[model samples]
Target: MNPRRKKRLLFASVLIGGVAAIASLLLFALNSNLDLFFTPTEVVQGREETGLMPEVGQRIRVGGMVVEGSVDRDPNSLKIAFDIADSGPAITVLYDGMLPDLFREGQGIVAQGTLIEPHVLEASEVLAKHDENYMPPEIAEAMGESHNKMEYSKGSY
Candidate 1:
């Protein structure tokens, strides 16, 4: 091959390799920071992918309806604890921060943090649904079949 063609081929290969490296690095960063969202039931039952309860201290997300009558707040501190339940199971969450204005029992929410135990999560952040009829899609999917949304909606739950 000609000298000019060889140089061009080498440059092209370098460019492609550089692009691939950057893409892989980006993917690695995203995967590391991305927390898998789980419902209380899934956490209780254990993850299908791993076939085991998440290790204690591994960061993850848990979302579900805030169990009715489970809210407890401290009189003098920001500490608040509540149970979030899906269709079949519930997990207790402990958070010490100003809760969202919309946070309440019977509402859908997501808690981001690490599992403190098999059925407890230490939440670093809590996210409530933005509006009525706006449950998170992951929670909705997890709650189907077993969870009776209508019962909860009718003011009975």
Candidate 2:
């Protein structure tokens, strides 16, 4: 209860409070912007578990190989749709913008968007493998590590 001690205590309390507030704000911003990554199989499982589509549309990234010959594009418009699949399952993605030059069937890709429907993603951005032999690191690691094990089903071209 001494005067000088009281001021020191007050300063310490204020400093700690400020730090906590700032930390809380930073965490809030990060959580709001954080995007979770999910594979097509996981997405399907989620839908099955919830039994309802359209959970919180927190931005998500799905990485997989573009199913061979699944690209569908309108003749006169930028709209395009493709199926992206891993060894497990596939999800259809619809995009309305110019695609990356490297995008093609049987290529690795990661799409960022919202799953607006059952097993469908309305992608806002799409990224394709950069080169003939190169894939995104995530896809590469996943394919390399789990190709055989992740093959939940076959015949999904």
Candidate 3:
């Protein structure tokens, strides 16, 4: 084979191999790290396509607004239960951990854990979701402020 042709073939093979490696890595990362986001309404509507229910030893996320007057903590066990709600039904979340400082009633929260039983989420991780209107200045600038509305109005200020 001509030296130039041999060099071109080698370069093409390397390029193809590199592309395949990158594609494989991307697929692996996506499959491993991707988690589904669901609202309380969706969960209540039975729309979870993956059949990821609140079953023992399963990892899942349950997101909704925390129902007011529904948060209770057991002093000795550190077990906490709160009602997670959307526009429709609500699900109860049970977690045993150090709750986040910002976690409170009526706030949006996403709990990650397994369903110990029907309508009960045993959370291993809890995430407090910032309101849609709350964003960093940079994000606000990039996304625009049209959708941002302060939950607390100037009248309170």
Candidate 4:
């Protein structure tokens, strides 16, 4: 090969390699920081399409209706535990902070936390629905069909 052509080729190769390296790094960063959403049923039985269960210690958001009579409070402290379900098996969530004012039994909520067990989550934050008619889109979609039959409240559907 001519010396000039070889020099140009080497420069081009280095540039392309650098670009690829940067792109791969960015993708890795995004994947690691992502917080996947799941329902209580999905956590216990795995997702419907992917059939993949979340790994322990992975950060995630779980949305569902707070199981009636599942809220247990520590009277002495802010710690509390509750079960959430979506027309299927329920998962218990543990939190150590004040809950949202709107939070209550039979209400829709999304809890952000890390999975500590197959059916347990160590929640860092819990958000309740703003109103009676509002349900998170993800939860609404996940609970379709079965949600209509499993009444969380009387005359509310």
Name the top TM-score candidate.
Answer: 4
Candidate 2, after superposition: displacement of residue 85 in Å?
0.3
| Candidate 2 Cα deviation (angstroms), residue 131 | 1.6
**lDDT by residue for model 3 over 1-157, one digit each (tens)?**
9999999999999999999999999999986665555555555566646664333444567776678799999978989999987656788899998888778776667787776766778888987755544533422342233213323432221
Best by lDDT: 4
List per-prediction Cα lDDT, in the order shown.
Answer: 0.87, 0.78, 0.68, 0.91
Ten-residue stretch with the least lDDT total in model 3: 148-157
Q: What residue runs in model 4 are displaced by over 4 Å at the alpha carbon?
A: 145-157
Residue 86 in candidate 3, Cα distance off native in Å? 1.0
> How many pairs collide in each candidate, listed in order?
0, 0, 2, 0
By lDDT rank, best first, the candidates go 4, 1, 2, 3
Model 3, C-alpha of 94: deviation from truth (Å): 0.6
For model 4, the local distance difference test gives 0.91
Better of 1 and 2 by TM-score: 2
Which digits, one per residue and each the tens of the lDDT, describe model 1 over residues 32-142? 798888888888888787786676878999998899899999999999999999887789999999899999888889999989988999999999988876777787887
* Ten-residue stretch with the least lDDT total in model 2: 148-157
> What TM-score does prediction 3 earn?
0.59
- lDDT (C-alpha) at residue 35 in model 2: 73
RMSD of each: 3.2, 5.1, 7.0, 1.9
**Candidate 4 TM-score versus the reference:** 0.91
| Better candidate number, 2 or 3, judged by lDDT | 2
